[model samples]
Structure formats: C-alpha cells, structure tokens
Target: MTWRLVRYELAMIRRNRHAWWTLLTLAALALLSFANLSLEAARANADKREVAAAERERWLGQGEKDPHSAAHYSIFAFKLSPTLATLDSGIEPFVGQSVWLEAHHQNDMLDRPQQKASLLQRAGLASPAGLILTFAPLVAFLLAFVAVAQDRERGTMRLALGASAHPRTIVRAKTLAIWGGMAALLVLPLAALALMVAAIGGRLDTDILLRVMAWTVLMSAYLALLAGIGIVVSLRAPNARIALVLLFALWIAMALVLPRTASSAVDALRPLPSSQAVRQQMLDEAAAYWTAEDTKRHQAQLLARYGVARLEDIPNARMAELDMVERHSHQVFDRVLGALYGRVADQDRLFSGLGFLSPTVAAQSLSASVAGSDFSHHHHFIVSAERYRRDLVNAMNADGMAHRADSNERHINDVRLWSAIPEFTYPEPTLGGTSGTAIPALVALALWLLAVTFLVDRAARRLMP
Candidate 1:
C-alpha cells in the first residue's frame, strides 16, 4: 500500500510541468557552472606545473653564485588544485595560489582571483555547491509544500482516511516520494557533473570516486531532511497558501540569512590580525633579536665552542652568526604566525558549532574538507613550504661553513649546491586529516535529519483531513 502511494505521488510529480521545468533549469545551470569551474581548475593546475618547472630551471641555471645569494633568490611554491575544487572552490579563490619561498622573509602567496574578478562576475557567479545549497532547498519546498495541503483542500485526504489509509503511512510515502524526486532532479545531475569535471581535469581516481560517493550521500541526506520539513509544514498548516508562505520564509532564513549571520558572528567573535600586521610583528622581533650585542654574544659563543681566542681564528665565523640569526627567526615566526593560525582554527570550530542553527554551515564544511580546499589543507601546504625554506637556507649556510675561506673572502658555489635542495612537493590531504572537521559536520547533518524525521512522524499522527 505504501509502495502504491509512493508511486502515485511520484507520478503526480512527473506530471507537474512546472516542477519538471524548474528541475531541468537547475540541472542546466549546475552543468554550466561545473564546466566553467572545471576548466579553470585545469588551467590553474597547468600553470602550477609550468611555473614550477620554470622556477627549477631558473634556480639551477644561476651559475657560480654565493650560497646565501642563491637562498635569497628562492623559488616559488605553487599549490595545485585538487580535483574536487571543480565542485566546491571553498577558500581557493580568496587565498592566493602560490608562495615565495625566500631567505630571511616568508613572503605572502600571490595571485588571488577575487582581486582580479569584475563586478559582474563577483555578483552573478555561483558554484555547483552554492547552487545546490541555495536553490535545492527552494526546489524541495516547491515539490513537497503542497503535498498534503492540496489533498486536504480538495477533500481527497478525508476520503483516503475514511477508506482505511493510515495517515502516518501516507505521510511517510509522500516523504519518500519527495526525497526521491529531489535526489533524481538535483543530486544525481550535480553528482554526474562533478564526476565529469574530475575526469576532464584528468584526476579521476579511486580517492576522487570515493569522495564523490560521499558527496552524493551527504547531499541525499540533506535533501531528505528538507523534504521531510516541507511535508510536515504542509501537514500542519491551516491551508496551502499558508504552507507556501511559511516554507518560503523558512527557506530564506535557512539558506540566506543564517549562513551570512553566522559568518559575521564568527568574525566578530574572533577577529584576526591582517597579514601585513603579522609580518611587521615578525620583522620587529627579528630586528630586536638580531641586535649588535646579540651578534657579538653569538660570535663569542662560536669562538668559545671552537676553542679560538679571537674572531679571526675561527673559520667561517660570519656563517655561524647568519645561521644563529636564521634559527632565531624561525622561533619568531612560530611565536607570532602560530598565534594567527591558531585563531583561524578557533574561528572554524566556532563556525562548525553554528551548524546546529543552519545545516548549510555543516554541508559547506563537509564539502570543503572532502574537496581538500579548506584552510587546514592550505595551512598544511604553507607549513611544508616553510620547512623546505628552512632546510634550503640552513643547507646554504652549512655549505658556506664547510668551505674553508678567509674572513674577508666570499664563498661561491655552483649548480651542485642549488641542485642538492629538493623541490617542494605538497603532501596529499588525507581523509584522516579531514576527519577532525568532517566528523563534526557529519554528526550535525545526521542530528538535523533525525530531528526533522521525528517531527514529520509526530506531525503526521495529528495530520487533519
């Protein structure tokens, strides 16, 4: 009987011309956006490779330069986009794609797309994930908001109840039908587009396939929850008109207002210092720590360690001072920059907590984490690049120390030392690392679905003809 009712509801939806048009329009929009973003990701990745190769050649071609000069002439580390970035760009556009790994100073990443975007592009653009989060709920409301109210208005609901149809069963069947229709219309189309984007970007792999599956399942659950909410609101509303208005208002609050408000609140609660301010702070600390007195103290320590009475007696004593300064700068960066990054993590956690109020927050968090475009993934690349820079600079200093030269002489090295430093390759973002953020979001989504399902069942028991 439930199966029959579900089939009947699905047939009604199939016959609704307006619903079909809306779903088709949504699918078309998603596909177009998917294609655009996928091409962009492909281009960005290609640029990353090209730049990396050119940078390497440039470094190696710098013939017979001082090791310190080579360190100063450091390479740029460009982060390649993950395949899933085509689906949800997350923070990629706002954050720069590449960092300059130079000596004595950690340079900011450059080439932020947002800075280059035109007004029209900024205002009109929507990602596949953005469309799903904003428009899919509206579509779900359109599909299910009148399911029971129209029946009750036309007297068929009373007829069915009098003819021995269970209200809970009817409600459950309608919920299933609504969820199935939504998944078929929105989820399946977007999932297909995501896979196509990955393939076109030449990154279709086992991990990507698994991530796509997880994305599909997550979206399906979200749709189900929305469908249940729409159905319950229809069941309880006094009339179809009231149900439509209430559902539309609910959609506005959930999809538009809450997310923006939550973000603003998070920013207000934990404001981060600007990048320039942080950089200046690091420079000031370095300046204060590398004073003349400190350098003299460091030189004395080196002399004592080498069992030499005078600075002239120590070989490569200047290299030792430079090395000590480099090491001290590392501590300064950690103390200042580390605090800034810690605040970002705190903000993310606070935003995740806001997921209880809006499922969009939870959905976005999970999507970005799976896509490897989240701040955590970006931070990992940064940490790795910094470590490489440290190794490169230290290696250069060590080379200068090893080559026995007079205090007045400069140590010049060839391509061998430059070639000795390994290229910077970012580690793949694992599911395990994402689990810390993803698990909380998954739980939030589950709690929301379960809560809405319970509401639907309870409302159905009191559902009037």
Candidate 2:
C-alpha cells in the first residue's frame, strides 16, 4: 500500500509542469556553478605554479649571501585547492591564498578572492555546496507542505481514511517520494564533481569522499525533517498558502538570519584584533628585546652556551650565527601573537555553538566541515603552512651557523645556500579532520531530525480515528 501511494505521488509530481521546470532550473544552476568553480580552480592553479616557479628562479639567482641573510629573505607558499574545494569554495574564497616565510615572525595569509571579486559574484554565485545545503531543503519543504493539505482540500483525506490506509503509511510514502526528488537534485552535481576530479588526475582520499557523502546524507535527513514539519503545518493550517507562508518564515529564520546573527554575536563577544595590530605588537617586542645593551649581553650568553670565551674564538660565522638567535627570538614573539589570535577564534566557536537551535544552520555548518570548507579546515592549512615555514627557515639558519665565518663579517656570500631552501607545499587536512570538527553540528542535526520525526508521528496519531 505504501509503495502504491509512493508511486502515485511520483506520478502526480512528474505530471506537474511547474515541478519539472523547477527541477530543470535547479539542475542548470548547479551545472553553471560547477563550471564557474572549475574555471576558478584552473586559474588559481596556474597562478600558483607560475609564482612558485618565479620565486624558485629568484632564489637561485641571489648573490652569495650569509645563510642568515638568506633566511631573512624568506620565501612564499601558496595554498593549493583541495580535490573537493571547487564544489564548496567555502571561506577559502574569503581567506588569503599565501603566507610569507622568513627566519622570524609568521605572516598571516594574504589575498582574499572574495574581496577581489565583484559584489554580484559574492551575492548571487551560490557555491555548489550552498545550493545543496541551503536550497534543497527549501525545495523539499515546498513539495511536502501540500502533501496532506491537498488531499484534505480535495476531500481525498476521507477517501484515504476509508480505504484503511494508515496516515503513517501515507505520510511515509509521500516523504519517500519527495526525498527521491530532492536527492536527485542534490546528488547529480556532486557525482559529476567526483567524475571531474577523477578525470583531472586529482587525488581523492576515500575517507574524505565518504565524509562528503555522509554530509549529503545528513542534508537529506535535514530536508526530511523540514518536510515533516511542513506536513504538520499543512495539516494544521486552513490552506496550503498559509502552510507555505509559515514554512517560509521558519526557513528565513533558520537558513538566512540565524547563522549570520550567531556569527556576529560571536565577533562582538570575542573580537579578533586586526592583523596590523598583531604585526605591530611583534615589531615592538622585537625592537625592545634587541636593544644595543641587551644585544651585547645576549651575544655573551650565546658565546657562553657554545663554550667560547670570545665571539671571535668561536669557529664558523659567530656574528652571522647570532642573526639566527635573533630570528628565533622574533619567532617567539610571533607565537605570543598567534596565541592571542587563537583566543578570539575560540570565541567564534562559542558563537557558532548557538546554531544548534536552528537545524538549517547546523546542517550547513556540518556540510561545510565534511566538505573541508569550514573554519577548522582553513585553520588546519594555516597551521601546517606555519610549521613548514619554521622548518624551512630553521634549516637555512642552521646552515649559516655551521658554515659562515666566525669573525664580525657583515655578510657571508653563498648563493648556493639560498638555492637549497625548500619551497612550501600545503598539505590539505584529511576527511577525518574535517568530519571530527563537524561532529557537534552533525549531532545537532541528528537530534533535530529525531525530534521532528517523533512530532510527525504524534501528530499523525492525533489525526487518526
């Protein structure tokens, strides 16, 4: 009986011209979004390679300089797009793409693509993930809101009740039919994305793919919950129009207003200091720590630590070597600034925690996490980049200390040393990392789905004879 009902519902939907047109419009939009992302990815990849190659050439061509001087010169590492990044884009478009790595002081990533793009691009060019996570649920709500209401309006509810078809079964069939349509709208583009990645020789981690798929499933569940809520509204309201207006109000609150409001609240409560402020503080601390009087004492301590009675007595480039120590001191100051920045980030997380009240917010956050486009994933890339910078700079500094002259030589000329520095390569976080960060949102989504399911069942029982 449920299967018959589902078939009937599918037939009814297929016969509706408006429904077909809506589906076609959604598919076309998804395809267009995918194409845009693909083009952006291609352009970004080309730019990265070109910049990297140019930097490498410049590094190789530098005049012979003390290893310490070379370390100070630094290099840049550009963030690469992850295999699934084109599908989501997330905050990546808003964040900088590259970081400068020197002996001391970590620079924040720079160049937000969103800031460079036009206003219309930012507002209307919905990411593929946005369409799936935000729009699909609304579509589901529209389809299911009139499921039982239309029956009641047409006097079919009486016929259905008399046919001995349980309301639960009827609702279940209708939900399944709507679910099928929503899934098609959501998954087709994602599947195409997977194929595109495969065709491009992109490395897709199985774990990450699974997490992405899980996010899609959760999104489907969220839509199911909305559909159930819509049915309840339909059953309670006097007309389909009223049910739709009520659903739209709920949608606006959940999908549009709540997440932004939560983020704004978090920023208000735990504001992040400007990047300029952070850099200025580091500079002030370095200047104060490297005063002439303090420098003499610091150099004395370095000589003592190396078991040398005088700076000149030490083998290798002692003055050149002291530069490395100064660089490390600057790095310590950077660490302090980084800690301050992290505190503000914790506050932002607390703000996002408020999304548990809205399933749309929860699902959107979870989907981005699973798709590796959330804040945590972005931070992961940043942390990794910093670590690489430290390693590369330290290696250059150590080389200078081991090979440069011990005398107060202002510079050690060594072009080869510059050529030896390793370039930065950003390794994207695995799916596990993204999924782990998204756990809170996923839990929230699950609870909401369960709550809605229970409510729908209770409501159906009330309607039963």
Each candidate: what lDDT?
A: 0.81, 0.69
What tens digits encode model 1's per-residue C-alpha lDDT throughout 103-181? 7877778888778765633642357777777787788888886566777788877888888889898899989998887
Query: For residues 5-75, could you state the per-residue lDDT of candidate 2 as single tens digits?
Result: 88898777676667556656776777777778777877888899899889877777777776666766767
TM-score of each: 0.94, 0.90
Where does the lowest 10-residue lDDT sum fall in candidate 2? 315-324
The clash count of every prediction, one per candidate, is 0, 10
RMSD of each: 2.2, 2.7
Point to the candidate with the largest TM-score. 1
Q: What is the TM-score of candidate 1?
A: 0.94
